[model samples]
Target: MEILERNVEKILAVLSLLAISLIFVYIFKNSDASIINWDEEKVNLNINDKVYENLYIDKINVPPVKAGDVVTITKKDFKLSDNNENLVFRTYGSTIDVFLSGENIYSYGEDLYREGKTLGRGYHIVKLRSLGDKTSDLVIKQRIVEDMSYRWVDFFKFTSSNNIWHEILINNVFGIVSGIFLFSLGAFGNLVYVVLFLITKKNNLHLSYSFATMFFIGLWNCTTSGIIQAITGNYEIISFLEYFSIYATFVMYLFLVALIKKKSGKTKAIDIVKLLSLLILIGATALHLSGTLCISKTIMLFRNYALIVLLVLFYTLYIDYKNQKKYENVLLIGNCISFALIVVHIIIHNFNLTEIMDITNDNLITIAVLVMIIIPLFLYFLELDEIEKYEMQIRVLKSLAYIDKLTGLGNRTSGIAYIMDLIKNGFDYYIVMFDLNNLKEVNDHLGHDKGDEMLVNFANCLNSSFSDDYCKKIRYGGDEFIVVAQFDKVEDINDNIKQLFRVIDEVNRDGEKGYSLSVSYGIASSKEFATTGYENVVKLADERMYSYKSEVKNQICET
Candidate 1:
């Protein structure tokens, strides 16, 4: 019942956070519906510029662009924008060229297309410098690779060079912000995993792989959003990272699940999937780098592969979760959520019916990716907390088993273990055995309570005397106690014995109780008795204690 309640609390907490986020989104969307006016900034490039709000485009299958490419051309007669302003074209896998009054002003990816190389995409910002000022003819020629034709430049934009980044950020705040958040979470998880691994020294590699999976997922998200490419304009590196991150995510996630299953004593069926993921990365990267195929074409293969693997994993984890209550329960939850979101996204994208109940599922991928990482991470921490509590309970039980109820010192069982450990290490130590005097008489005449009090008081004296790092004090039995210590010299034993005697005298000063505590002790040093073995040494100590008790009786008779 308690476990169910804890799980419910965590689920409610996550749902509440999502509700708060939806509220914020609602407020942001409703806050402003007006169009933005950029002319209010100090750099009023649009003031003197002849910026047209619309452009006329002609779709042409054309005289042919290779065999499968799509070519589009647009021509217009209008006044060119101000020389200070620039025409920016945000394009992907498309070769774009601008002509002002029949003279070339800007060209991008033309050589790549000519050389039959993949034109990885980024923004092409063109400078307008004196195109004869009068009504000039503008022409834009474009060629898009067939596989990457989905990403096309939809419109012509003119802005100052300084405002390009500002516009990019304004357009992609959510992507950049969410990307940073996901990446930050991955980093924090890594730090936590490191600390936890150092402390526990147990099977915890799953967390590291899980965090690595999350890191790459965030990298892919941010890079694919085009914000990083817009900022750096290094489309090649950003595109490489985007492809590499998918491969890494696939491999890391497989490893994470495999480790979890292995820990749960499951068979090694997932290793085949792990190998397939690795082969996909290696083969696709080799082909893409060799110009035989584009990485974009491999995305379909990855998606199909991921769908099959996730279904299998979902079924396996679900069965395991139902059959047994284990840590993998959290993994199953994350896996199911991700798979469901992915299936929804696939259906929406394929069927072209993204609008459901007046809401478009544009953020499904982001939500799925974040949910896949966050849910597992949160629930894993909860599982770890429970494991720590179990360990604490075990420690408490062990401590109770080794401790004496009446005296608080170690009991006879613990004393034997302590001495055995010392002998195992070949240490020269001294054993001091103590037997409380007149305990039987006190129990018979003054009652057992007073005898128990005397026994406790003497144990307290022994504790006060032998409370050093190398000393082990134990209540051997009823009215019998022992202190085993590693001392540099026999002289140190005498000093400790004197200290014990001093404490005993102080404890016996309670005359109002009509009783005093007394103990006869015997000392045996391992240095002298080791030749006879440890068992004989203990027997000798017992005999010497009885001899001392006899001497005490004789002295009392003389008095």
Candidate 2:
């Protein structure tokens, strides 16, 4: 029945995830606005013999190009029916000047020959004035400011101003939403861990590293998806964030190493590799900030390095798993999936074969990384739950070991240990030793079970008379019991004993077991027996108890 319930819960969880994913896909698909693909559209371009032209721009092949080279595109037959509709031109990898009937309408980026001006790197959207029934040719003159092995435009899309923004949002909707989800997951994980650390006053490095990794990966997705560019329109900030995200990965790897060390113990080699990765990240950041190296140019190399480091980290975790380290299996599974996705992405990117891979507009790799982060975190939480349950079980077992089964009081071993602990701690306590009178006689006349009832009755009397905060009551042995209590004055102990006797008298009057219960007890104090030690005090209490028992026997004989 328990196994069936668990399976049902698993099925429900899978259904919930599928439902959310379907909803996400549906929303993204519907948000797309109308867009014109230049390659597919019937647009005529007049490119002079100096520049190459292709009927299908998507399949264009071209020669090498350097800075200051100009290429003109003239769409002569294009006409707009709506005069109020604004023209939006989008492209990448070069500075562009748009002209309508030989008049320059908009310009982007610095002059082609400018030395220090930053060149545009990613998608750019320029809005033009209303066409207004003008049959004039639409012309675009693009200057290649960055060196390119192939002189080809990556994207050229034509749309209205409103649709242009909408298209950008639509194109990046999955990334934007997923990035926010990842960020929120990371932030919430961090918040939970921070609260736990504050309450428990202990550090959890594994969760810390996991959250940091997720946060930076989410930030990276946001930047790469063009969402930040759409919102801020700051190329420099976007560019810097790209590098920052990469560096953040390096730091995140270091944290992962720290977590591994905490779980499975450290190795000098792993430590050295972590340090080297940190130095490389720092050096790259420094060079980029100083303009000594272009981050865009070096990003692929850094990614390659990061992939190598990730593989190494995964291998180390595998080794730890082989060594039977706890929770390593979950980490290994998550890391392996992430590693495979990274490998696929690298291959597709380097070969420019995203189309062949059918992953041109997909965020599968991003989702895989999200899974990579989430699975381990989920497993960690499960482990925590198990630990808590195990600890609770241990507490229960320990209590059982120390408690008496018949009377529900501390057993002999625990009672002795308690007194020894008090003596070692130098706490002053009054000790009371008790022995039930005529217990053997009751056991022989009635039964052992009835005698056990008497023992329980006496235990109930002790519990009713003494406060747990100040008193330790134990069923020391057969018919023998002991109590150790702390009191502000010696008279307080006497008063408590008088109260105990009254409780005993009340229980005797009830006569539920058809027999009267009686006890002979002796009291001693830690202060009075300081020179003799607590063990001797216990012996003295035992001797006085026997003496009291004998005196009661003589009174019984006389009666």
Best by TM-score: 1
RMSD of each: 7.6, 6.9
Measured with C-alpha atoms, the lDDT of residue 153 in candidate 1 is 40
- Pairs in steric clash, model 1: none
The TM-scores, one per candidate, come to 0.72, 0.68
Model 1 local distance difference test score: 0.66
Residues 249-290, model 1: lDDT tens digits: 878878877765775565355777788888888887787776
Question: How well is each residue in 1-559 modelled by candidate 2, as lDDT tens digits?
Answer: 3334334334433432454366467656764533432223333343335644434343344344555566676666456543224544434446677877678877776552355554544566555555566677767787765455432454455554465655655666777776666566557657766766666666767667777777777777777677777778866567677667756755775566555556467445567668877787788767666655553355666657758877776767777777745665777787788778778776665555525432343365566566665655555555555766787899799889899988999998888888888878878888889998878998999998888888998999989888768799999899999998988776887788899889888877886677887889888787775373678778878988899889989998999
- Candidate 2 overall Cα lDDT vs. reference? 0.67
Off by over 4 Å in 2: 1-50, 54-123, 131-155, 161-163, 202-208, 246-283, 317-336, 354-359, 362-364, 381-389, 410-454, 464-502, 512-559
